[model samples]
Target chain A: MVQLTTDNSYGTWRFCAWNGMIFMGVFIVFWGIMGHNVPPYGGDMDASVIANYFRDNANLVRLGMAISMTFAVSYAVWGISIGKVMDYILGRDHILTNLQVWGAGLTVVPILVSSSFWLTGSYRPEALPDEILQLLYDMAWLLIDLAYSVTSVQMIALGVGCLRDKRAQPFFPKWVCWYSIWVGFMFVAEILMPMFKSGAFARQGILNFWIEFMIFFIYAPIITFYQLKAIKRIEAGEPAA
Target chain B: MSDEQSALQQSGRAPGDPGVWFFIIADMAMFAIFFLIFMAGRHEAPELYRASQAHLDSRFGLANTLILLTSGACMAKAVMMARAGDVAITLRYLLLTLGIGLLFGVSKVMEYGTKFAAGIAINTNEFFGYYFAFTGIHFLHWIIGCGVLTVLIRRVRRSGVNAENINWIESGGIYWHMVDLLWVMLFAMIYLLPPGGTA
Candidate 1:
């Protein structure tokens, strides 16, 4: 049996771990539903049509994107907590731990910036030209999709760290670790987002939006479940075996 | 018997890590989405799909399929050799598998070059989009599979195969087989299936 280290900040760890769930909930409701991005405007949608959408639903888009942007950092907070736990498992100052934390922190940047772009478009839809509105929308999608590698880095680090835990019982199950890596690898498909306008690889297409985004949404709660459980075990000073 | 064999006895006849099956299953599901979407698109525009698919040269597809199946055979043989504690033969078999797999890559690149020469590209149409994206993603898997084979070869060379190291070889073989299986499916769906024919 491997010895589990006692940590003084277990309470904080619990809080940060729970924040992942909260982030998922808030992001789904605010950013996805209220922001009218449940399916998102299509890449092939006309510029004037997009402009009209913002012009018609300005307040909702504004409020939704604003709130979603604020809660986006909760993901970062949850990541930091996961990083601390990984540091405990992998050892202090491990390169993977650093990569995990850094990746998590950087993951917030694209989310924040993209959401702000949408919010800006809705800030005063009437003042911006139709093409400019479409430009902002396009830019947001590119930033969000292309910047996926940062999150991939975070996921791979965590997955590798947990997989390497040679304890009788790893912090995460082997299936979860492999699934995390799979999800990270799946992000490679997002590279097609820039190339397609109206197919399964498009921003609003089935493969890109439905499969990619849903997998990401599903990954959050799964990791949070394991993170909460691991934190609980550590809090009780239980042996890993 | 080695520890891996003993463990295999205990866990039944499952090869490699059972956990790898999860990755394999997930990958299958992902490709299922791609296939489903392709089918859906075909249904939407049957004539266009028929025309575009007609442009594909089945010879290249057939060659690649044969290449992968041959490599998969080599990989299986290598795993058998490793299990038999024949490290030298295992290394040789791995190298052979690597060479065969590289032929698939070369064949695919030449096919793509022919397409480019004829002014057909991924963005040319909906059919081409599906064509490129599906095969392109599978191409990535092939590349990764090649990398895995290289690692296995190096490991066998450096450390030799034993009970502890056998799992790595088994797992790598399983992954390589999956790459082959996926390409086989891709070839059947993209090359063999008539545009209007449902499989």
Candidate 2:
């Protein structure tokens, strides 16, 4: 059994665990709130309307997207931390653990790339044509929504790994494991997003944006809570391997 | 029998892992939301929705419903037989369930073909959009359930039902039932419920 306590990396592990919350907070405030994407502009909104909003709020959008792009790395770092814990539960070379980290790492690409598109649109919204700005905005949403499977894989990998833990007391409870998988599966609804522009399947609509994204937000906090507890247990000299 | 297996036999205990229950409840809640959205859409353009919905062949939906229900019954029997250590009977029922599940998929594909042949599609109108989205999502669930059943069949074939493996069988059954339950609700809302009637 590996002695997790004397490993000298617990402090870093704990800090990385905290990154999950930090990523959620910064991403929500800057990417979601300040960027005016909490519900996002409607997919069916006219180009002029979308361009006008960006042009009108150029500075705020630039600030939000720029900061969002930077902090998005925190999500990957958080994944590494979770993957480390999973490594202890499974082996370091375990397929699921590798998948968990890889998924988390790849998930950053779309978020960062999408944020760049939004940032570029807002970079000089005054100089750009309405259609050009609208194209950038639509591209961003498409990239973000369509690339959701990576994050879903991360969630499922984590959930399945935790469920496989046969310790006397598992790292995460059964409900959280299943809930993580459920939230991951729920992202399938986003596949319909590009098809509908006005109804519930639209990017800004109720089901796609509100319910789908909200559950993810809820899932993050729950997983973080359990992870923090699991870290403490390991530090207290529980055998991780 | 192990304590876990003994507890499984108790009347008050739920079948499968508690985690699966969480999934089942969460899944039902999402479908509930989907149903609500469908109702809200139908309310916005009752005439259009009613007209589009009228084009659907209720017979197709009815046939799929019966097929899924039979599959669900077979899965339940499989779970029971597995618990009773009747590995041969369990495999038979599991195979039956898988066959019925395939029938549901085939029927759905044929129904989609009919719509396409008639110039109706997912993007035809608001009603068709909801129809395709709802049924499509449910179809994915059924496909996954079939996969789960396949695994259980393989497990029983290899080692039969032991204390360690029975929970997996029960959990797989629970998932299959959920697929059936969701379809029944889908059938009623999309097929049986006529426009301007609430019961």
Candidate 3:
């Protein structure tokens, strides 16, 4: 309930914007830190080419530190803005407890699965018997696909929430709401794309780089910046109604 | 459109949920890509991978898994307690979640610490590299979840936790559960398969 957001003057979402700018700073620093032996950014090498590089990066902590801190601090403010949006159209009746439980259950399980995935993602295929190699490949592949599928649902709900809420007019941007919905819809692409894993465009690791790079370099920062402006505006003055 | 869709469009409440989910999607996307990278990378060095993986310690992974399992339960209980409208009990469960979560962190730090001391730097090769990078990232998340719960507990005490405002707690719980879920995969990938240190 910060009535003090508008005070940032530069904008309500200033902090988030500032955070993004700084994060990009760190990301840029990534190149300098990773001098000389570069991963095949533009073209050919297998994706392992990149993984091994990061696998050998001086310290995982340094880069990770930059990502986690930026998001944590930025989201702290971001969450407040979300709370405000929720208050705007307070629901007539709380969502049924069952639905809430389902949501909570669905949400919780993925966290556990991902955590386990953390330890497991690193296993080298050579260690396992060469005999069952294909089986291992298939299993791991299927598991990841399943995990990604389930987790994507969480994002869909989020997108729906943004799309449905209109009072967010002054605070939340139309782009954010719509983009969220769009992203939710796009996750389906993963399922469909993999079905015909033979498609060169879909299989080529390069495509992932181009699309993901855009999200990181362009969309995330812009959206985060806008979010920061909204928060600052609400935090500085005239508590958001 | 259905009545539900029409009502949601008119009333801001339906769409007004905070941007946490949106932010979470971004984070999850990053993880997904890295995961894909890891899998594809391992596919290349199956021999070195299997050999290196055989050398890893599953016991630690299992123990860590147990700790996180308990923490997830604590997180769920914290939400239920807070919803029950008893400040004292809610605070207790929140504290429980925090303490258990911190223990998970400590265990991970110790796990990594022991590994490092034993000369298993991330770059020891792709196998060890992935070991550190993946688990290392998970460790980072556990720390964040702990910090979140710590702050949340303080907030619950200062401002009562009622149905109107309980989403905050639920959100944190959702995040903590994610931290736990990731561990399950981590164990299977890093410890169960390839035989990290075994023949």
Candidate 4:
């Protein structure tokens, strides 16, 4: 077994952290403060009234496309940044395991199903002939979407198991394991949205969005703050591992 | 041989060097926020949800999944190498890890670039919009992971720090795995929404 010890990396790590924060802070401020960032507060898909509005505007349509790509990249980078910071707090060395890779991945299906459901919730087939309705869903799209939702939920459960397996990986914290278990169930709850009568739960899910927001947007950043404080301890001549 | 032996020794990972816990917590938040946004958006649309997924490319999902799995394995081996405390071997694995990360990153750039070129942009549909966004985020992380690996390799060679510290290697490995795992979701959600012709 190889034993490892920590020493100052010629202060480069500190400089890197400081500089990274500064750059990221500036961009985050612009994205948030300047843009009045509304992060997916659920859209009105049922509003043909609203759809008709966007179905016409030229600039709004183009801007929408531009904004989408920007958000995509944003999510990607932010995800990474968050992951790195969390690892820092945990005092762990093993970062990625097969389990985590799969957990991060398998949850995508349910997530997509959830996102798609939110985006197009307003779609109400106007008295389709049974044949057409059959053909419509039978086109294999709805089934896959449904499967994605269901499978995604299953993946979440599997992810929790994966993350919790200390034997597989020693780096995951106890709080994180429990946190994942709790969080995983939330995604599982999402599957029930489709089963609700007339997407009623879909709307309810929006109402419940704050619960998620509190955990992710609010609680998560708070945890990061704590992690940073712990890192400060390490900097102040404390042992992390 | 003595100089090489000295160079091959790892130092500086006692208690101050970074570790995997930070990255794991980071993974938690990243996925947490992602799930939050996805849930928020999903609650907004249910009908287009099904059809949009049905249009995905399972082949792409499987291929990328394989790529990521291979990368994850390479990274895990790198961690194992670091634990062995052989600077040269650890550096070799780090380089290989970088290569795999680059491969994944380049493939993503190609795929997303193709979409951009084809005029079928990210937001072509609500699902596609989110699809590209999530994966795009993962891609950026992949690039960062490669950068981290590169730095570790150089540090080990230049007599800078502990290349054999399990914490450092594991931290990087965890972060990379997070990226890899995110891709798994991206593949399933964005590409393989339909399996065996039944969406």
Candidate 5:
């Protein structure tokens, strides 16, 4: 049985991790109801089409964006919890742990920035030209979808660190490690998205948007589930192995 | 067979850890999504898909399928031989499996080369986009599986066949079978299917 030598108890941050899940649920519901979710106004719709959509749902969209911004804060809390766990496992501050922390911090940027774009577009749909509205919409999607490197790096760092836990009962199960690596690699597909206006690689296409989104949604919950379990066992003073 | 071997055989259990199974299930789910999306694309443009598929070399696809199947058979044999306590024969079968797996990789690279030479790319069309995306991802899996196999070979050589090592070897075999099974589905969808008709 491997014992953690750190003085820090992971309990407080574990609660924060659980709260992150709640924030995720809030973001999903608010975004789905108000932000129009992905493929806003249907994936392939033109600038005029999207502009009209914002015109109709401006109030709801703005409210949704405002609420969704909170999701970034939730993510930050979750990321810190993850970094703490990683540090605990390694018994010291390490390069990969730092990378994971930095990556987590950077991930909040896209969500916050992108949601702002959506908010700006919805704030005055009547005053803004269709082209400008479309530009904002495009920028929002590009940041959220194409700027995936930070998240990918975070996953890789966490995954690699988890795989290093060689105890009989590892801090993370091996499957989670492999899952992180595979899903992280999948983010590379986003690079092709900007080139295609249609097809599976398009911004709203099946491979790029739907598949990627579903994977991320499931990935987070799974990690959180395992994390909670690990914390419970740790609190019980069970051997890590 | 030794009494110990017989006792172990009677204990019915799946090879490898439950973690690998979890990984496999999740991977299959992801692939299922890709399949569904591909089907949807076909429904939208039957003619384009059919035309694009026609350009693919079915012969090459068939050859690759055969190689993978044969490799799977060799892997199965290697597991059996290892269980029977015949380390040398197990090594032989494993080597054969690795050889055939590499052959499949080579064929895939050649196929991509031919496509590139003819100016076909992911951006060519909807059909081609699915083609490259699906195959490209599958190819990456193949590379990883090969790496797993190589590691298994090294471990077996260093530690010799034993209870613990056998479990690790079996896990590697399971991963290889997954790669093979995925390729079979891909070959049918990308090569054998008449595009307009569902596979």
Candidate 6:
């Protein structure tokens, strides 16, 4: 049986993990307020139209990216906490655990790189040529949308681990395991975004953008809900056998 | 016999584990979202949707629907037989379910082949996109359901419908029924409904 100690360090990590949803919620508000949400969806305009918006809202864009960066870091922490529980479930180190951590760690890259690009575009939109600004904007969206495979890998790892749990009361319920797998499968649709400029498969399309975002938003909360419960069980001295 | 009855009584509370229901409910909700999105798209382009819908063969959809419904019936019979400790009969029903499921799969492939021959594809239009996306996903579920049926058949054959194995058999049957239910909706929405009407 695997048991976790109810100590200060573990307590703090668990607390951080539980608050992962807050970080994401705040990030969404900031991003929306800064007007970065709409332009990328193609619901509003092309890159040229958005370049002007970025040029005008430079300071807001910079602030949004900085705040989003914090959320990215928080997400990594949450991922680590999930990996820890998964490790306990397996009772030993496993490649899936490593994949979860690695995938979570690499997820930060896209957010960081995308935010940096947006920041650069907004930093001196006046100094940079319009085409250059447009290029930067497109690059940011591509990284954010297409780089979803990293998160998919993380989902796959956690899902597989959960399904493999053989305990009477598994650390994660079987449904959550299937949900994780389904969410990971849904991200495969992101690959179609670059090929379509409009319609459901496009970046701004309902399936790819709206439904995908809704799923992503719902995913964090569900995982955090289950993860917090699992942590509480561990803290209460429940064995992983 | 009492033991078997008790097992059946237990399985009666839920066809599968609570977790399986959770997955099914969530999956249905997601499909509902897809339906809503597809409907909204149709509203935006009624004529285009109608033209695209015309390209789909309703008979193929009807055929697949009948196949799945038959398979689902066999699945139900198999579960009943398993609960009665009739392993041989249950195996027969399971095999019948598997065969009908394969027929459904074959019908789907033929439908897709015809569409491809006509140069229709997922990206050809909004209607085609929804057609392929919705049916394509349901098709994946069918494939999974077939696999589950295969496992259940093997388990019943090996264990002969013991108390321990009954729960799994019931779970797989429930999952197959869900696949069938979803197809009924898909068949009606994608094939039977008028292009401008709601599913």
| CAPRI class of candidate 5 | acceptable
TM-score of chain B of each: 0.93, 0.93, 0.83, 0.75, 0.93, 0.92
Residue A156's lDDT within candidate 1 is 88
Question: Which pairs clash inside model 1?
Answer: none
Q: Kindly list the per-residue Cα lDDT of model 4 for residues A20-81, writing each as its tens digit.
A: 24433432344223322223212333334333332333233234333332332332233333
Q: Between candidates 3 and 5, name the one with more favorable lDDT.
A: 5
TM-score, cand. 3 vs. native: 0.51
How well does candidate 6 match the true structure in TM-score terms?
0.82
Error of 3 at A32 (Å): 15
List model 1 lDDT by residue over B52-126, tens digit each.
998999999999999999999999989888988899999999999999999999999999999999999989999
Better of 3 and 6 by TM-score: 6
lDDT tens digits, residues B82-113, model 6?
87889899999999999989999899999999
Candidate 1 displacement at residue A141 in angstroms: 1.1
For model 4, state the Cα shift of residue A100 in Å: 32
DockQ, candidate 5, vs. native dimer: 0.38
- In model 2, what is the error at residue A66, expressed in angstroms? 0.7
* Predicted model with the maximum TM-score: 2
The TM-scores, one per candidate, come to 0.95, 0.96, 0.51, 0.44, 0.83, 0.82
First chain TM-score for all predictions: 0.95, 0.96, 0.48, 0.45, 0.92, 0.91
Q: Specify the poorest-scoring 10-residue window by lDDT in model 5 chain B.
A: B1-10
After TM-score superposition, the amount by which residue B179's alpha carbon in candidate 5 deviates from its true location, in angstroms, is: 1.2
Give the alpha carbon lDDT tens digit for every residue of B1-199 in model 3.
5453465468765222255555456556656765665666567667887877766777778888998889889878777666566778878888888887777777777778887788877556766756776676677678778888987888898887865446678778877887888888778766776532333
| Model 6 chain B weakest 10-residue run by lDDT | B1-10
Tens-place lDDT digits, model 1, residues A53-135: 88999999999999988899999999988876776577766788788888889999999999999999999999999999999
The best candidate by DockQ is: 2
lDDT of 2 by residue, A99-202 (tens): 88998899999999999999999998899999999999999999999898999999999999889888878989989999988988989999998898888999
Of 2 and 4, the candidate ahead on lDDT is: 2
Docking quality tier of candidate 1?
high
